[model samples]
Target: MQSNHTEKMSSLGLSAWYGEKQALVNVSISMKANSVTAIIGPSGCGKSTYIRCLNRMHELVPKATVTGQVLLDKEDIYGPGVDPVMIRRRVGMVFQKPNPFPTMSIYDNVAAGLKLTGMRRGKSLDDIVKSSLEQAGLWDEVKYDLKKPGTSVSGGQQQRLCIARAIALQPEVILMDEPCSALDPVATAKIEGLMASLKEKYTVVVVTHNMQQASRVADFTAFLYLGKLIEYDETTKIFENPKEDLTERYITGKFG
Candidate 1:
């Protein structure tokens, strides 16, 4: 909103319920294309649930239901005849834990999604895999030994491998849930730096517990508390001069 950026995804009065219990309130946020938007909030505030709804991952849970609409490129993802598999391919996800297929090699780990999407194996797949690893900043480290187990690499490299796997799909958007929470500071920094470059072409939405991380890499940040969206604005404004008292208090470390 600050820079006249085009919106890539948006939610209109979105709410979620797991069986009888509600997890997210009516949440609406327009995410900028080719920009990083960080979702920050305390635990149990529905940070994870909100992003899960983006690609319809939330519905995978039993008795899950959603109200309102999630739009990707102005198309309602939850509308009738919409394919969840197609939406997943268009909007990828990287979990908090680096979940490279343990049984697969580095090459296969990146190739798994492609194969599932009916991408025939050939030079095109090979080229895309190579390009994706390069984009994720992990090719150089593992290029020589792509045959090695994906988890054989260090924690950070494994995380980058997962990022590469997501990138291989050439998704327009990538949702990361605390992607660096398991890594040390050095590894965390690498992931953070990667996100900065990633926003050049992919609309990224990350849910992070580290407030400093949200402040550092996000173009815009949304603060949710107890399932309610307290404030949404440019990162600088949210951190420096939030309009809401709740936002100010949270940013100041008074309460989170």
Candidate 2:
């Protein structure tokens, strides 16, 4: 579905392509402003690819290419003079696994994104670092040891640190690719709660292998199969009364 560019944070259309092989096929969806949208599907279904395409990341691969428009606030991200770095700054990403900068302290890790955008040496930087960590819900745990290496934190803390890093730049949209897949149950729960709170301020697009996680945190859910979006609807409707039989079967623990 083509999005109303005027008000949408992100939108995609008939967007598909490949290295001489088509992966996504005319997939279209509009991400709402300041809401959580979860993409769920079996492996190799192009869930990850779809997210990457949002910031013009798919073309980063040597042999990959895509056609169709992906807009951010009505401006085509691929338009001439649009820098990928600038696009990414507006659209932050958190990977499946926690990836903290090993050499940096927790404070520095959170401030890393700001440094990339050229914010350095001031109260502004310090305030952003602290506030970002607080927003990620990690400040209470690590505030005392801001100097500690990020790798010294536990798995869950490390993930939150990564989130803090993303938020420091104040991106309008945050893309999370299976962010909780690496954490234990308790850690996963914390991240889900964080997601819930984050939507109040930032638009979040998440990809998840865990169906329950999708059900728990998503305001909207989109199901994909073979790179095609099969169903996109309110999370409750999609979970409780999916329009597509494939979605129902998958949610019921049948073959993914």
Against the correct fold, how does model 1 do in TM-score?
0.96
Candidate 2 off by > 4 Å: 1-7, 120-123
Compared with the true structure, the alpha-carbon lDDT of candidate 1 equals 0.93
lDDT assessment of candidate 2: 0.87
Which candidate has the highest TM-score of all?
1
Clashing pairs in 2: 14-26
The lDDT per prediction is 0.93, 0.87
Q: After superposition, how far is residue 68 of candidate 2 from its true place, in Å?
A: 0.9
lDDT of 2 by residue, 1-256 (tens): 3231224555566465677777788788888876789999999889998998887777888888887778888888878898988899889899998999999999989988877679554568888888899999999999999999999999999999999999998888999999999999999999999999998888899999898999999988999889899999989999999999999998998873
Worst 10 residues of 2 by lDDT: 1-10
What would the C-alpha RMSD of candidate 1 be, to one decimal place? 2.0
User: Cα lDDT for residue 224, model 1?
Assistant: 94
Q: By lDDT, who's the top model here?
A: 1
For model 1, residues 141-165, the per-residue Cα lDDT tens digits are 8899999999899999999999999
Candidate 1: pairs in clash: none
